[model samples]
Target: MIANTVRQFARVQQRRTLSTSVPSGVRYGKSFGATWLGDKGAWPVIGIIGGALVFCGSFISNKIMFHPDVRITPSKRNADIRDWR
Candidate 1:
């Protein structure tokens, strides 16, 4: 009786393993942004906007880091050093 039950259990497990149903026509590769914004004629506009944001960010960061006045005033204790130059 135990052997019959084990055989039935094995049959049920085999059926469960072999009966997996994956839906057809499903896309796994496309991005959510591509789907939302659409796959047609949207890339150039996105590229231009992304490029502008990068350019503006770099320009602002450079302006803050390398401006001449910023280089002259390193700290409060070094204020007198400016007079030597």
Candidate 2:
């Protein structure tokens, strides 16, 4: 998409100040890309917290915003029956 094209152009326009060459004796590290399933450290806790947040959000919001909204209603003292509708 356009995002990739913009990233490509931005990278091409960037200047390097230091050599990025790796040491000759160093072997290539892990080849796998990151995923939620593969994550054993933070992902599990993050997912539980995320789910809990979604589940509890409405309740928390309603409690925090709790207020009684008053509305004027037609009554015999101030309003005629014919004008009630």
Model 2, position 58, has a per-residue lDDT of 76
* C-alpha TM-score for every candidate: 0.42, 0.27
| lDDT per residue (tens digit) for residues 29-85 in model 2 | 634433444568867788899899987997767755552232144243454333333
On TM-score, the leading prediction is: 1
CA deviation > 4 Å runs, candidate 1: 1-32, 71-85
Task: Let me know the TM-score candidate 1 reaches against the reference structure.
Answer: 0.42
Q: Backbone collision count in every prediction?
A: 0, 0
Which residue pairs in candidate 2 collide? none
Q: Candidate 1 on 1-85: residue-level lDDT in tens?
A: 9999999999999998777756564568888786647756878888899999999999988987766555534464356454333
